[model samples]
Target: MVKINILYASTEGNTTSFVTKLTDIAAENGDIVVARCIGEETDYANETAPFVAIVPTYLTGGTGTGPEVTEIFTNALGDYIAFGRNRQYLKGVIGSGNRNFNVQFNLTATRYAQRFNVPMLFAYELRGSKFDAEKAYHIIKPLFGE
Candidate 1:
């Protein structure tokens, strides 16, 4: 069976909802998805399989139109991946955001991919529509190779 590992962080339930749909879709299609959501406590796993990370954008300072997209709102995912062991297993990144945020949209995912030297694989707006979930599922499925 095709298998994938999904590591993600969500605030305000949007990213969690998206990952849940992605996981459910994988199961429906007879694929395997081992998914984990970061929480208030730092959780690290010795991930043996390749994994993709998903994060939503939360930037501090300035409106989208301004030049001051300064900081990421949370460091939880950063710390989770910073476990040193975890970074090697990361395969790619997906992100969620409000398009209205402009340059800051999906900023966390983009930065994570860059920092970890992985591909910026996919992105969806906010919680993502069912169509977006299906699209993400297809994109991820191919990565596992039948």
Candidate 2:
């Protein structure tokens, strides 16, 4: 069976909700998914399985044109990957964001994918849509030769 680890953090729970959907799809497809929620107080571990990261775009303005765009909100998520050997095991990233944010939508996941030299596997708005989880599974399953 295909196995994937997911590392994520949620602020308003949108990121958590999206990751949950992915996990549900993986289960229905007979794949193994290990979902880990990382927080500032969580201990770090060197990942042994290929993993995906989920991050949400948090902007100061609803229009995303404000000057308050900052990385401070998801510092814990970034720190989790920055820990020993975690970066090496990252397979890809799936981003959730407000599309109303214009070019800033899903920017966090895009940045992580680029930094880690991995694909930005999937993206969707808050908590994803009815079919987004399934679509994401199809995209990622082939990467593991499933």
Candidate 3:
């Protein structure tokens, strides 16, 4: 079985709930999954397994055009990617944000994907739906050569 690691950040638990559902889906597909909250004591830089990231965008400077990522995510993931620690690993990115924010919606995930050269699998909204979970599963299934 392929091992998939999911690193995530959530301000109000929406992203956490979404990740939980995605984890269940990945497990059902027979992949060994490891889910870690951003601030948790996990060594993302040293991870050897392919992984996915789920981050949420928040309005910054009172403008939708400028969004800020959570410190927990930026601190951990920034160092991991900036230093090219996980550059050789296959990865995906998923972002969550409020649609009302318009231009800033899920932008954080987009940035992370570009920075890490990973695929942007899905940009889910607040409290991701069942469809998002299914999409996540489909994206990860093939990584195991299934």
Assess candidate 2 and give its lDDT: 0.80
All candidates: TM-score: 0.88, 0.87, 0.79
User: So what's the TM-score on candidate 3?
Assistant: 0.79
Put down candidate 3 lDDT per residue, 64-146, tens digits, no spaces: 44334233344555455454556556477888888887777887787788777888888888989878888877886676455
Off by over 4 Å in 1: 64-73
Residue 114 lDDT (model 3)? 77
Model 3 pairs in collision? none
C-alpha positional error of residue 144 in candidate 2 after TM-score superposition, expressed in Å: 3.3
User: Lowest lDDT 10-mer window, candidate 3?
Assistant: 64-73
Question: How does each model score on lDDT?
Answer: 0.82, 0.80, 0.71
Clashing pairs for predicted structure model 2, backbone only: none
Error (Å) of candidate 1 at residue 99 is: 0.8
Model 2: residues with Cα > 4 Å off, grouped in runs? 60-68
Which ten-residue region of model 2 has the weakest summed lDDT?
Answer: 59-68
